[model samples]
Target: MTAKQRVIRVSTEQPTYAVTVLGTEISIDVNGFIPRGATSFDVRGTSGLRVYVIYNPKLVTKPIGAVRWPLNSEVEVIVASNDPSSVVNDNKVRVSYYGPTGETLIANAWLYLTCMAISLDADTSRTGVVESTANNKTKWTWGPHGEGAILLVNCDRDGPSSGNLDNAYPSVRSYEDLQDMSLMILSTQGPAGVFDSHKLLLHISMFDAGKVRVFHVNGNTSLSSYEHVLGSDKLSYAVKRSDGKARHSFFVEGLAFPDADFAGLVSLNATLLEQPSQDLPATPVFTDTVVFRVAPWLMTPNTLKPVEMFVCSIVRGQNTNQKFLEAIKILAKEANCKLTICPEVENRGDRWIQDEMEFGYVEAPHKSFPVVFDSPRNRGLKEFPFKMILGPDFGYVTREPKNGRISSLDSFGNLDISPPVTVKGKEYPLGRILIGSSFPGSGTRRMAKVVRDFLYAQKVQSPVELYSDWLTVGHVDEFLTFVPAPDRKGFRLLLASPLACLKLFKEKQKEGYGGAALFEGLGRVGRITLDEILADEYLRSDSRYVQSCIDWNRNILKRELGLSERDIVDIPQLFTLEHSSATALFPDMVNMLVLGKRLGIPKPFGPIIHGRCCLEEEVCRLLEPLGLTCTFIDDFFSYHVLSGEVHCGTNVCREPFSFHWWNILP
Candidate 1:
């Protein structure tokens, strides 16, 4: 056949194909086969481009004279259509062998094609610039021919702003500043067979202006996922900000610890949303390091912030506990402490107030509890010198901060059953405090490590371990507490003393009110006697164990927190039995509601009364000599019986440290 009569056939699953002969390459598709006179095409290597034929119910060539028939022959495959309006059937291929095999024999050698290859030899180059305004807005415009193409934008300091990629970005800065602002734009080919995307990389690293933010101009809103990257150099986390829109907005303030510095590059990969086959960039474009900074308070964590005393608040229901609330208010005034009344639906509901353990935070920029913020505990903290610190949620918590440098405890810790407590160290400066307490078996040790590491990072101390084995309510405040003294880093540790309570009981018995009269008409059974109450299974069974715990606690406080014997205050309070369980009385005064040096002790209700010379009078006498004042607050709900006290009913937000933690810690 003449060159004009020559026919070539091609078939492949991919949309594009390249045909090469000698040193020339020709782009071909099923719709337009090689022109009648076409012959030579571009070539890169010594050999020509090998073409493979794909057929339905594929055929195997029979070999003759030790040579593969089709392989040894000069054969060409062409997909031809006589009518221009007819649909091109990619599955059909017309074969023509110019060597030993003639046209008729070559045509019957193989089955029709199932797919045809289309050329991918389109030019992929265009021009455009990424512009970022002073107000922190970014926009990119493509050249005239660049349309219908995709651009993946990314901030090196922030993670992937478009879709998931291999390159990691920096932590989201908690505060607003443009210390390390950067953007990289990647382009992909458009449907018009042209490089219709503009690529630009902006190096706008300005400080104190704004942090890096990522946004998408246009792309697959459903398939794209945006990440808000935040964390420290050692640890990092990404929060997906995917809103299923053409644009995804990432703000620095959305991070938990945005003030932390992050050093790294970012990447962007673009994929065009085209027909039969999509055009995608193989790699992401990256940028250099980005700087992030914030206020000192956001940088360092403060635990022992100096306070005139301490801020305190109690929870009360508008419909219930009016008398109890009133009593606490008066006591708060005497102590000169700023007090707030957190409102609840029911005064006695388990979740109404006391267990709002997750409501407050020890540090500023506290995490918001979606549910608790609507409660009364969300009041302002202007009157208090420091903010009330909230303990860990103790459930499903992570060791690293979820968004930024702010660390979080793992959910394995059981706060409801774990008594979390804090103590200021005389050795460390203000805000350089530690929480001393023991974790129950219910809590995981990972929580201890997380808390410690986080506090250490913040230049504060971790919680100390205390004895919680003997009490149903595993809280340090159940047996011990502290009051800041006038002296620097000096505080008084108040401990529960069974010995003192016994001594007072003996003395009261000699005066005739400590025996049957002390228990008559008290507790669940109105006819119970003091002797009977003490001899009950609850108190008798746990007394020995509790005494041992008290001893262990006192020793650890002196060793860990550095409290001297003179600095210790033993509260003379007796334990009783209720519902076959051991519990304490209002005079177990160690659970006193504390505001600075003022103590709000529960009004004594046990049968030991010498007119005004009751447990209240005795508690006052013990506190008076230490220059500490005590006020009586009513616990009409029998808080101790319910596994709580004045302390549990309240939360506090103390003042920030007198100086930034960095100045004192370093």
Candidate 2:
């Protein structure tokens, strides 16, 4: 019976000695020479033009010198006569084949060559090797022990005469040249039994650095015709079928003034491909991603920013100072910004909904419900109204209990304001708030502890604790605030300097202006001379003690808050005994309000009556170096008479910043 030609893969546990080719069961012997699995080796079809097999050298106990196939067929395989002495180690065994019309054909084994030609024919002869420069016919060489080799197909009926060939195959001209061959094969014949050689190597040469190259490996070919695709718009590529290294080159450059994405975060996406074909679609291997990020510059403080608007509370009869409110309203209108009054309706506002109740809550929501209020009154806690906070993203405000509160402890009245402090070259939110150890373990220190905890959670530096038991109100606003510097990015600490105030008072006295007028309009107190009031021991003692507190806090500010002596701009004013309470006039400027770049100060009734330069002029003069425009409101009856200044009467929600809070958090 004549045998039909077929390609097959074979794997064996022992060294292949001989293989019996037959339509029925064929067999092999470990010792190498017989057919055992069937009664007789009868070839019904021709098999083995190419062979793929698995046989590890380490697994073989003995080598069966040769692999031969005994068959009855017209088809045959004639290997090169001058091949290696021992085919035991050679993974592939290539040979020639003859069709029905006597045409010669050559084929290679799959991963490893086991054996080709199921039946051997007698008329086997050698054909001389022919060299050519045409696309169809090309020169070729073999790897070590014929490990990697290719099958050549000739268009002519009669194959060339065979002879010794060159040492190695020349480098592939370009990646496109190799890709062209693949596309031709895929279009003419489908992928089934075609080119199964695992050792097929396509040597690609990269021409340009930025151009993308795609490759397709062993792909799905279940249908009669098969195709795959992968494409990229930018610089992207995929190498799906490459085991050895290839030559490559890349060139890149950077420009000093190139347009770029100003948005801090950027994302990049890319797709990789392998062995692209012109007719067949490219194969998709994988999708990759890359990310780039840059942090933003620090946010400028409100004092340094242009006014966007003014935020205030409209709680009637609770803390309203009509003159102070009207002045702020006029200033907002002049500045062309919105005046946001809380509660919308009159007398319906929460008492703690005022600006001072919540400090710098500008970021998108960072914490959750049942938040702290930091006030003796619970205003913003219950409703959490949008009008009260101004910004949708709100932070927790600390609240002090009304029933069992410690008498010496001061409320959020002092905790909310934080002077901008610079650290590690970056300015953080609420850089430094002054705390007091005067009421340690009491609500005063408790409030400080809460503020410290909150600030730390927000990744801000902790507060600097100062002695506040000396002050009558035990608050920082009465003595200090931060204001914009003339031509800088930072703020200057506006301090109520008693010494500076004394100097100004003496200068006024020398001009025949008596000190008695400084005590007028001070809430109808009993008659008392300036000398009589100054001689009181309590007044003298309180003045000296408060001055010491200011001095001590000033040093703490310099040390912890990163301030210099030059950064401290003193406001002149003197502490006076007001019947039973103590107060100051000129230095009360520290408690002033900032309306954009303008400074809203209270016209000191005492200083004006005592024949000093107008309080407005004096303040503007003192702050000229720092670039402050002063507006003196007649606040004698509304604010100064009530133990409070402009700040206590009004609150402001400053313009929002450019940076997102989440991006800067630790």
Candidate 3:
């Protein structure tokens, strides 16, 4: 692409000269340089320079070596220099006017030219490769073939004494915070006086000013040396060049994510402004632009290694979750993961920690960190993520519905992500995001549009909506989860199969254990025998309906995640209808906490046959060969009876995928 030309009107009445950039063109007024009575004119320039006299409407015509102008046609004069001037006024273009003879010079005008080189560059290649010669940096593209610079949301707090995210405050708090931003280099090479006469301005559009901030680094080692140059209310900054360096580097940090209105693409430009006179305003002589697309927030699947675990503990009550917390503590210790327990005073009886928030992360070529996305449920744990999790390298983000309306499907439990997979020939290295919504055209409960739009805007983890409105809690975790595997796509999708549970029960009845009762030791709940469970027609009908609902999503997962039957594990589970929505009949086994090779599952007190619970044994047989440990925690009283299970009461923050998101084709 050609650089925009700076139009300059040359006057013969005064000493005419102009300083310009090498690659940029200057439009000159030919008639203004003509003398009062001259009828003909000739234009010439230095040896290596070209002066274009455009006669045709289209500027595609070739340049002529000689030019003699009389009155043949209207013309436009353009001056271009391919190389920078070694010294000021060394290259000159002159226009001489003559009588009708065309040989006798009546008057002459001289325009002395000095050229310089200036450019602003970043990782415009979109491959995380920075090239100083990169051009066309103003536009951005998407997909594997896309090209544009990438900027990270400086949402992590790098300073130990900071009270908020690094992006929340404009000033750089520490040297570490600068590492998370993208680097932009401004290079200027010319005579020293040219810079003094012209002003270098760094500017951003007012609309994008709040989305990003630019900082000029004066020193390498100290936080005090970083200067906040452009952001927020500041649209433009006059860059000082007192030190006279050839190259100046500025760090660009993203402050917000791509949402409903923002496309995530932002541009910053360095402009060289020249003042024609003290009385006239400054005009831009040249400009170099660079675009950056902010990194999207990405989710971490259970297949990834767990780095930290969050759970809520109830101090006093019959429904206290102390036992559940203890079990998680042991599991966390075994998994070598950090554990955080939110006390009852903070959670206020809300034990569904998983529903409150989801842990994900944002990444750039320079840095990355975990960011917790808080659900708009505004429940007891609403303040938990912001007040506790958002600190010292951790980030927080949330989206609330504009209509002030939200459903159970809006909970984070309805928000899950698949392990990395390639469907057909397309690769999803960051995996696909799974969100619960009503079936198409059903007009039933669905996730809010605002939240859905936010997730979809992320681009990388293309979201897949599943049919989850059939459940009472309306959460995908009530029926499906993923666990790490030693082979076959590195993970196994565990789905709650009512058909599998019925088959197991029928097999046990045939084995002459029909009289064995479920919930054998629980006092608060009544027991039901295997024979009685199989005999209830309404229960059977409900199980079939629930199975069909799960099967609908099962097919979607198969197609979207590129999974075969071997990639899925069917855990024994049954659902019963309540108020036209399905709820777990016993503790849900599929809603388990996954920590690498270990899993904390809810104790489904199935009928004990041959000295063991068949439910537990069946789960072990299905998963043990794949190197997964199953420890059933008793969540029956604390969570199961309350319409939740192990996974609902706890949330896990896992390590980010090793593959950079920018490497993926969305």
Pick the lDDT winner: 3
> Which sections of candidate 1 miss by over 4 Å?
1-254, 257-320, 333-340, 346-348, 351-354, 358-426, 430-459, 487-489, 510-541, 576-582, 585-587, 607-609, 636-638, 664-666
Clashes per candidate, residues 3 or more apart or on different chains:
51, 30, 0
Clashing pairs in 3: none
Q: Per-residue lDDT of 1-666 in model 2, one digit per residue for the tens?
A: 222323232222223222212221222111222222321121111233222222334542221333322222322332211121122223333322222332322221122222211111110010111111112111121212211111110001111112111101111222322311111111111121212221122122121111122223233322211211221322332223232222211101100000121222222233222233455654432222222121111222346454343334443663455556678788777656666554425224433233235334322111111112334433343333322332212323332343544432244445434445565575655454554445344333344343334433433334566655545555666778777775543677887876665555556556645444443455553343344434457755656655666788888777776677888877766665455334763337777777666777766654453344444456778787666677777656555655667666555545444433333332
TM-score-wise, the better of 2 and 3 is 3
What's the CA error at residue 416 for candidate 2, in Å?
Answer: 4.8
Per-residue C-alpha lDDT of model 1 across residues 295-409, encoded as one tens digit per residue: 1111112123312222123354332455666777676666565665543322224322433332212221221111111111212331111122211210011123334332112
What TM-score should be assigned to candidate 2? 0.48
lDDT winner between candidates 1 and 2? 2
**TM-score for model 3?**
0.89
Better of 1 and 3 by lDDT: 3
By lDDT, the better pick of 2 and 3 is 3
lDDT score at residue 259, model 3, on the 0-100 scale: 89
lDDT agreement with native, every candidate? 0.36, 0.39, 0.86
**Cα deviation of 375, candidate 3, in Å:** 1.3
Ranking according to TM-score, highest score first: 3, 2, 1
Q: Score residue 70 of candidate 1 by CA lDDT.
A: 42
